[model samples]
Target: MLVASLTAVGAQEGPSGITQRTVFAPFDPTQRGCHKPPGLTKELAYVQENEREFLQGVNHGLEMAAKDRGLKYLRSVAENNVPKAVEDINAYQAAKVGALVATSSDPTAVSSSLQRTIWSGAFVGTIVPPPATLLLNAPQYATGKALADASINYIKSQLGGKAKVVLLTQDTMEYLTPRFEAMRDAFAKTPGVTIVADIAPTPVNKEGGFVTMSTVLLANPDIDVVLGGDAVVLGALKALRVAGKDRPNQFLGGIDGEPEAVSEIKKGNSPFKASISLSSPVFGYAMGQFAADWLDGKSIPQAMDILPIALTSENMAQYEADLENPAAVYADPIRKSTYLKMYGNICYDTRDQYVNFPWSSESSK
Candidate 1:
């Protein structure tokens, strides 16, 4: 389902018809364009743009992991601007940080800046959007389709597959656009399903979602199905409730397992039915640990597969536990491996293979 932008583990099929992928590859950093650096400084800096509950989980894990590893931590917001991020990273590199844990809305726009940060001898880690030594994101096409399946299933179970839909998309972030496309594709064949308002909210936040949905409701008040990330969808839900449109017939779903979205689903009576759980804190902790490992001259996962876990009432308890305490989960050897798919050990010695944006089609054996 998540086909595009994915480099599968190779054509190794198992009993379940699932392709067991080889996401790991041997990296040779001796051919790097940048010079080498001294040992790790036992310090990492976390840089992000937005202030969503999802990112809050990430930063929380980073802070926790920094504490676990006995490392000092620094953090800053880049405001989602390429030039601003460039300048911010320049400041961090100058300070000689050992690792930089980061995420970006536009990896393409900030590619040069990130590459330079890695070149400055600081091991860089990225989530969702890339161009770093360590990159993490749910496989777009697959994760999107999975979320769509949940929404489509909900529509069939509750709304008779005949409902007006609103798709709030984050299509500008290249990898994430496929999720909205999956939603469109899933509802395409279903009869009586009408997509009244298909829009791209500017900020992709609660306010942006509220503003967009308000206008959409004015045009198509009878809309019953909504889809997008937690922030926007929750915002849309607020807008709907304010207009007295929060009915049982209406169904909504989001991607991130934001606290509010999960709470809405837990209500067992709200229009919000599902939010595809990305397990933010779990992955965030993994990224932080990997960042420290790279700085320690240890080989790290060449690539990782962050599979989506659909969060519902039945599974929310454990997911919340994992979110609240990632270190405990990572303590279990088996559970740690399940959270992250490690390919190969990577370090500065493999800087040449230190992933660049628009990752290679093939993983080196």
Candidate 2:
């Protein structure tokens, strides 16, 4: 039996005119990786660690937001694994519970199991960054591609419409290959963007630095921009700096941000031009608010799973403030308060909500 408490706080009109309810749930991460394989490469390990930190930060931000609003909240006081998540959902469904949130990465698995569950709606939040395939498969890649194109165009405008470029990425990132391939194809068609060297490392381990930097310098000495995926590239940048190869005038950019990367920029010594950040705090808070509204018998638009906004260096300061104080991030405190009310004392539960799939008995079969 899952024991939880619910406290209700009043609602307020959101900027979209939707009455927002606050729901606070204690979040846990220990049980989310039941099926995760061991011995991941350094790049994958970095991504996982960064993702965990991002989620924890978002949760802390939400807690602050909840306290500011004095809304009702729920707290879960149990710890369970992925399989246990399925059991909990099944039990809830058997009791004809009105609404519930379960976490899992396989949406198809969740949908298959919970198609007839008691909940009127459900939402899935991934602890992992979207796979390269998922990102490239969507129209969003067009946006990323366009951003890359614009960067190249800016370089062209400065260097007279033709420049030699080297694309560097860790070889183990199989998923990003498609997107990089798309980028290569796009660059091929552009007037002045020449692919001087497209190099990949052997295994994407700590040695990725030696392999990538050596290859870039040897194969493409005059390379202008170094386009890479994430932390691996950051590592390569550090290696370049250590070797006294990183030039301030050259351009360096990639997808995600890390502390080291920020430090590099702050020093004003590295070639890092810009980084792409998907604000996890905003995404998590939005998910929490949506869950609260759904539980409160409110209507959610079919387009609720819209892509989150991208953060660039220009507007990153505003999000940095939001990360520090979520209450100030959104204008509608009442709606946020209403959302917090849904979670009651369940905030104490540290169980991973994302490991379980479909809340139906048939899922066990």
Candidate 3:
């Protein structure tokens, strides 16, 4: 379970009789001169879940950061296979890889391996659910609200505010529940914006989106707005196009400013518009920087929040430029503020205080 607020005391047993440790405080961006001399090798490895565009963006950023930081960069694709992910992480740990980052299809299955890596005194960074020295997360509620609010505006102005909407969700993931909850809350206030279908697509991918949307069209064929992650929503768009049901005025928006989704939005005539940009590359670069810092015995953020940006054609070019040159974005305080919000601090000396539960700035509130 997620431990939102930090505990200042030592380890204690939870109701489930499991030990929970919380010794870290909120990150002091002002505090300085804290260092934990390099103890591990200068190697950074990423255990990627698959070759999806979002994950690929992460790989690109990490690779770029590795090159800039003068560290050996290694990558292993899990191919969405949980066992493969476990094997890859374990191998990295055995090899004493200094800093490691991972994204898993089943985080639970790989948690033990990640924990082992942490025990080895190597910096372990995780995308979300943890057992790591550094964790990356976005405010799910704010992210969902951003996308929903945009969809509401487009529906009101272009579709007369009354439209059947389809929400592709991932409600099974407890951490992601708030995103859909936020969407439902916003739409509930808009009477005409009835949610014709609210369901989690099986497999939660492009094919899942295509299949789910195809089934939904069997009844409510007039969906005006579709909201969800990029992969599935893009699949839904494909389904819409194949069925000859897509219209120019339809507002099809999604989260995760995927390349394809951005292209669709740029088309202008297509229904896709306004993807909420999590900017994986930007955060990936930050993670890589943190890893390098950790190896150098420098303090780094214990957790980070990837601020969401609502993307449109107007901002696409600049966003693309930032993704391509994330180091530049990280170097610019003003620019990095727009993309990331970091919290807590950790270094090799304080590694015992590493985050072991799901941590988020939004949830801490």
Candidate 4:
């Protein structure tokens, strides 16, 4: 499960007399002022799950934010090890780090320590699942729909509305299951599409995608559309290439706007056509800025949304530029809005209201 069960420190009414929901009210910074005096804490730490490029972008943004805001940046890669992630958080907490950002394969294993960091008057940011002063999440169903619609359109326009599709999924991540659900919903509407394989790859990586696709190909030798996260979809592309079954007109789309996926899309004739992006650098920079704000007795959003952008060759250059200079993008409201959305407010004084449940802006409806 992506979201850990609520602890004794569960949700409470905010200063505005409002209870927490999937979406939050506009931030009232005045209610949550600076947690500490300026310069008392200057360290921003990250407990990374692995060396995926999506996360490396977050690390890059954090480092840049640290340099710009006069804070020290430290990082520990858990490398998908749950215990290592716990140890890293404890070590950072022991050092009294001012701000912490973390991504984990298993969040419950680290939620207690994360809560401790929050109770210690420090900024805690987590991707998706909570126990964070500033929680970041994507609109899961919408993200999946974007990629699925793109592939569906291709199937109609290029494949004459009839195609065999493979859906590499992450059904194991309960929070992320909506992505595949959305895909299934969209494909269900397309009468000409047949999902030849709907399976979650083991380990959910490139190698896993390769292995899963290899197995799927054994029974179904033809696949015209492949949709999933960038990592696995890229792996599926490799498997198809190896099997000599990849076609110029086939549509292979993914989420996470990964670099390799983009490179594949830029190939013009390649099957990789689209990638839905949750721009990490832009959000990472925002998180770092919030860290600085918290240390300086300022108010920051209690939660943020990393808006998804469907990447294509048409917009690849500008996206790369924004990724490389996320600080600049964060400084510009218009550009930043394209990648992120902010809600509510929390500072040191009001952090008791930190998010402790699975939150999503989509559920606001």
The Cα error of candidate 2 at residue 181, in Å, is: 5.3
Cα RMSD for candidates in order: 9.2, 13.7, 5.3, 4.8
- Candidate 2 wrong stretches, greater than 4 Å: 1-123, 126-139, 157-160, 168-182, 199-216, 302-314, 332-365
Residue by residue across 75-123, what tens digits does model 4's lDDT show?
9999999999988887776677889999898898898878877766678
Per-residue alpha-carbon lDDT of model 3 for 42-130, expressed as tens digits?
A: 89999999998999999999999999999999999999999999998888877778899999989899987876676666788888788
Roughly what TM-score does model 4 have, to 2 decimal places?
A: 0.92
Cα deviation of 306, candidate 1, in Å: 2.1
lDDT of 2 at 48: 13
**Regions more than 4 Å wrong, model 4:** 1-22, 28-40
Global lDDT scores for all candidate models = 0.73, 0.42, 0.85, 0.85
Whichever of 1 and 4 has more lDDT, that candidate is: 4
lDDT of 1 at 148: 78
Q: In candidate 2, where is summed lDDT lowest over 10 consecutive residues?
A: 40-49
Candidate 1 lDDT by residue in tens digits, 44-87:
89878667788888998888888888779999887667566666
Q: 56 in model 2: Cα distance from truth in Å?
A: 4.3
User: Which order, best to worst by lDDT?
Assistant: 4, 3, 1, 2
**Candidate order by decreasing TM-score:** 4, 3, 1, 2
- The residue pairs found clashing in candidate 3 are 27-344, 36-297
lDDT, candidate 2, 1-365, per-residue tens: 21222111111211111112222232221222122111211010000112333445545543443344332333221232444444554444443333343334343333333433311122222332221100001123442464466457657765677767766654444434544665677787888777787777554422574567666776555656766644556656766666677677666666544445545555655677655444445544544453343333333321112122333455556646765655554456553332221211111121112222211111122
